[model samples]
Target: MSAAARAHNPMPVLAGAVLVVMAAQQAIVPVLAPLARDLELPEWSLGLLMTSAAVMFTLTSSPWGRAVDRVGHRTVLLSGLSLGLVGMTGFAIVCQLAVSGVISGELGMALMIGTRSLLFGVAMGAVPTAAMAWVAANTSTTQERVKGLAQIGAVQGLAQALGPASGFVLAFAGFLGPVWAAPAVIAFALVAVAVLLPKGPSRRARAAAAAEAEQAEAAAPSKPLRPWDPRLWPVMLGGFGSFLTLGLVVVCVGFVVQDRLGYEGADAVRMTGLVSTVVGLVMVTMQAFVVPRLGWPPWRMLRSGIPLVALGAAGLMVADTLVLVTACMAVLAVGMGTVGPGYVSAPTLLVGPAEQGRVAGLVQTVTGSTFMIGPLGGSALYGINDWLPFAVGTGICVAGAIFVWTRKGPGETATAPAPQPELAPDPS
Candidate 1:
């Protein structure tokens, strides 16, 4: 179907589905300790669970993009939910039944990692890519697309807030019980998608849109998009750096609070949880209220966000008390909140509509890559000094800002990016 003739679609259903995927994924963080105990594995070995899932998420996103392009978005999304259900069920069963006497610790860890990865590969498949693509496809104008992207960002932030908080709250009720919450959530999400989703651009709609486009052939057409447009790299680099910093922070924060500050395990977890709560709330407010009021280009937000992240990380280097750490985290959250909305919108605006899935996937892949590397790097650096990871992570953010600043085009802050010409609708 042609892009111009396409009508704006209500995509709240798809956003809700993506939120389910994220919730399932994020729930594991708070439950990991109980999982390790149930499986009778060492902390180091259990770490493989995340490593495996991240590896899968990073490797599979592109193929998932291709699959969505080939299959319908709804089909692929259902497939992902099914995979998540199976993976979570497997985790539940394995934890309930696996005999440490027979399975051996290393082997058990390996099994958990494999199952976790399989689950992640499926649930995460089309979510990030398809959800955004659906938005870009259905939305009729650049302004609407920004609104769509902002909502997406807000939903993701809400997920970050609720997912772990819910898990932890359930954990507070009792150990191991919270871990069971994921399956139920996934199941409910599947049902919601089934009921709420529109049958996705109908065949008749596609054909009619296509016919109208041919009739308007004499009209002046928009310029073809340059996928490798020079402005793209700075934006992309900033995104990569931001995720890298985030990745490192997630993995290292607990260790810093415990080892460096001489806190107990519970204290460390609470501190991290508090930081997450603040970050999530701030993110929601920024996207919902602040971004709209300014009407500023995304690049401007990115510029402000990157340096704030640096300041937050730098503050972490000196923070010795919970209050100090919390304030620093708040600073970091503000920086991240500023940059995040813009980063989410960057590839969508840059690549045009036709390639939204592939390009958005590529952009999300940076996030996946950060997940793959950040934990490992942070853990190793934490061994050297608990403060070193945040310090170095801050430096990386600074470098990314410098790179973005040096680039051309009035700070490269695009107000309204061009949209792609629509492609022939897939029959699959």
Candidate 2:
């Protein structure tokens, strides 16, 4: 990799943009239930905020990917952050209204859901779609794809480390402090993206890549990558199950720590943040340091990880101490760190450059589907009993992992596949 290639590669700025998006969303998680209680909302309302956004994320993913294909990465990145800033500001206003008694709990929840989840979900969806598409379009081999997707997981892992801690710190200013300040952070990220994200691939470079993709499509007879496609469904199932388990756990963590360990109010929020920090750090260490060196194949990552996840969840069901609980959380994060890159990389190896953006969107859709329903389910089950959600969620992970372990690699087609489209050299 040379300076020129490095100059054109999108991952670095793309990474910063991704960090901002993930951090901002996750920052709200730990305090969400407490804030809802203060505003006199029921337990189910807690999931509504994320669920609404997730629903939109799932619904709009394919279109967002096509928008990137239509408009180019730089344009979409700029616009997405810009919209996110607006949504963030509007969300803050809605929360302030509820906190100050200007709006009723139900109305404020509805307003916040529309403002934050719906608009924000649509806006933030673009960055990851561009990222996955870029990685898919650029990498030719399974090893390279795994490394690239691992890079993504590592960035997200870092965000997870920071986001919860920041929220905990910000909560000192008041419950609404993180909410009010998020827009400014997004505004700053938007500026950085404008300054740092590249204009586009050079005209000649774009023309050559386009021509090569056209040639490959003509030869392969292009079909739009489908979520239900036979070659891809196994990977999708693995991702959906693992992440759904994540959704279940995350939404319940603050409650679990608070109830099981006898923490309350701000202490619960802080303890939840502590649990998040442990998980985040572990994921970062695994994704950044351990994964690239192990050189394991994607399915191995899937099979190896899901069982760990099940074990972790099982521990959570029985563990009474905060220390034990945090240990379980750490084990679960390890599982996430392992499965994530595999889930991200495997499908790209099964397709051509032509389908990268669509695949990216579908991957995002898989993640989105979890948040859409998982949060509400987790919260509801927890309300019934602390351990019930984990029991059910662990069961799901076991089922999904077994499915992956029993099946052969989808990338191992019956016949050797067509050559990958030639891509530009990566940046140094």
Q: Considering every candidate listed, which one attains the maximal lDDT?
A: 2
**Highest TM-score scorer:** 2
TM-score for candidate 2, please give it.
0.86
RMSD of each: 4.8, 3.6
Error of 2 at 271 (Å): 1.7
lDDT of 1 by residue, 183-231 (tens): 7888898887777655555666556645654454434344433334474
lDDT of 2 by residue, 197-277 (tens): 777756566566566655655766356666789878988988889998988877877777766788776667777777888
Local error of candidate 1 at residue 53 (angstroms): 2.0
Worst 10 residues of 2 by lDDT: 419-428
- Give TM-scores for every candidate, taking all chains together and pairing residue i with residue i: 0.81, 0.86
Q: What TM-score does candidate 1 get on C-alpha atoms?
A: 0.81
lDDT accuracy of residue 355 in candidate 1: 51
> Taking the candidates one at a time, how many backbone clashes does each contain?
0, 2
Scored by Cα lDDT, where does model 1 land?
0.66
